[model samples]
Target chain A: MSDTPAGGGAGTRRRGRPPRTESADTRDRILVAAREEFSEHGYEKTSVRGIAKAAGVDSALVHHYFGTKEQIFEAAIAVAFAPTLNAPAAIADGPLDGVGERLTRFIFGIWENPTTRKPLLAIVRSAVNNETAAAVFRRLVAAQLLRRLAEQLGHPDGELRAELAAAQLVGCAMLRYVIKLEPLASADLEQIVARIAPVVQGHLTGP
Target chain B: MSDTPAGGGAGTRRRGRPPRTESADTRDRILVAAREEFSEHGYEKTSVRGIAKAAGVDSALVHHYFGTKEQIFEAAIAVAFAPTLNAPAAIADGPLDGVGERLTRFIFGIWENPTTRKPLLAIVRSAVNNETAAAVFRRLVAAQLLRRLAEQLGHPDGELRAELAAAQLVGCAMLRYVIKLEPLASADLEQIVARIAPVVQGHLTGP
Candidate 1:
């Protein structure tokens, strides 16, 4: 809710410079601020104004760049899962025999790292708390990741097959990370891959 | 708070009823109240006093019957999952090969029904919202359901296997029921059972 200025507008831009498209740095700041806000206050309580203030931009700029709360949420989750979304392309190049092991390892490996895990935890917690957020998150996951993976699998029921595989991984993440249930929580990563790979394989390629 | 019936502490009972060990009706009322309070306020903000007030019983009686808030939470969830907890025994009695179909059908059947689903949704939402609630939920699920299911499976890592199976179902539920993702959400119950049963069977009985 900052004022435009004495001359009106250009509040977030430099004083002497001509107005221009938002800088990449500025865009990154907004996304980071949005992640923190969504994590701290959850999806329902967070606002564009809050994200803008946190990023040192105006709400108008946030709106201009991201359009709506749902758009911003989708953008935020896309960034968070960017690393994850890259995997299916790489994994598809691999032989189908090891697809399950590679896929499981790839997903859980991302989760085992604190850097990727933190943003993901934020996205999941927000999504779980609100249906609107869940819908947004669901859209991003299906479009960006699961659908692509499904296409690679080449099943008649490819999307459902992809989703079932995803459901297994999502459930493991909830149990191991979010809920921190013992046994599964403390099980070795490689061991988890060994155990869960076949189930994922069966989901994707089973009769 | 109601005046304590002259002797202080039998307000939930009618005067001259000479209070026995809390009637079944009173116990059921308290359980129902606890479920509602936990559902509406979530685990962190819900209070014993709130539950007692909702049930029209004194806080002391709630404490006396259920002990602490955690215990009460467990009791509340136990009631919610009572039907589920019974499934392991029944399924174990059947041929091991049919275990997956029976288990999947049994679980999704409960979810397909509104009567059992309402309480379960409450428990899942509460658990998802708070770590304390998650931990409590983890313990109850492990102790009551997964362990029994695992014991019957006769795998060395039976607990992990059982948890892995639960994780897939839990994830599917979150997506279909909680997130209301399309296709999966609107998918037929028997179709889901048919699709997912083999993976569950693989998890339990596979090498």
Candidate 2:
């Protein structure tokens, strides 16, 4: 299983047009390698060389794809956190008053999406185990998600309340996805959002 | 720093008939060691031997102290979580229907105590990074803390609501302690709890 191909043989059987430099593919390969390395060995322990080796690509290719390890990590984080970050916008772009309903629906919708949730779990796991990774997680969550939410609220303590709301949301995620707490683990996403959204909305919009 | 005396020479200067083998103290030391180890390395990487080494005792002594790594971890968790676990009881035991205020005061008070907060932060950080640690965290938080709060509420969804409130409180702790977000990083405890507790109480006992 360790020797299993990382990306499946689909890459090997390319027949049409030789794929125009394969930069995007190589970048993705490096990202997958970085995620595995960071998850398994932690951020401090995972190196560019290690990621390159895992990706089965040359070190120069890895560097070419990402300027530095920090860049690679930033990319990994962007991918991992894109769902949550994208949520506020999705909710905001919709009807305004039901922001609570929309936000809750969007947030839980991401958690219910396996493709998004699995990477989130991995990112959360990595953050817990590694300081650098935790820092990355913090930066992404705070800057991209929380700050925007705070800005949207425009209350005097908007930032703090936004963070508090984030804490509640993320904690729910931790319990539901990571811990797999009973009833909650199997609970319907719509039900959860409906139940929890008002509370989150209260934090975001209440006095 | 690594070579510095374990407890700043306090370990060597202890006198008085070898101190009555206070199992609590020994158990406490072992738990503290386990907390640090688990925080730094997560559950899988944190070994009994490593904790023992950090605690300046033999690996056998660790077993004698706590029987097994899991037991040691449980002890550590109990210690780390004692504040939150005990808070519901404290609040319930207090006078009258100010349960929300009492609970909020108790919860914030624990976060303010450095002795408690440090280990709790470690546990939270560990839970984020490791599945077993996360499970242990969930079990303890839900069984010991949230259940008590839920039972006290006696509402239909009291249990779920308690869990939600617990998540909010813990999430606040995560941001204040682990993520160290600004303003919140320096917010007054009384102000925060006062503002947030009513919301929690609403979750606990509302229409």
TM-score of each: 0.84, 0.84
- Per-prediction TM-score, chain B alone: 0.86, 0.81
Q: Which of the CAPRI classes, incorrect, acceptable, medium or high, describes model 1?
A: medium
lDDT of 2 by residue, B1-207 (tens): 111233334455455423334455666677778888876676677899999999877899899878877777878888778767887778888653577778777877877888877777677766666667767776787788777777878887777777666667766776777667666778888767866787677667766
Q: How much lDDT does each candidate structure score?
A: 0.83, 0.74
**Which digits, one per residue and each the tens of the lDDT, describe model 1 over residues A82-176?**
88898788688778888888889888988999899988887887777777888887887878788888888888788888888888998999899
Candidate 1 segments whose C-alpha is farther than 4 A from its true place = A1-22, A56-61, B1-24, B57-61
RMSD of each: 6.2, 6.2
lDDT of 1 at A201: 84
Model 1's DockQ score? 0.58
Cα lDDT of model 2 by residue, A91-131, tens digit: 77855557767777787788889887777777766665556
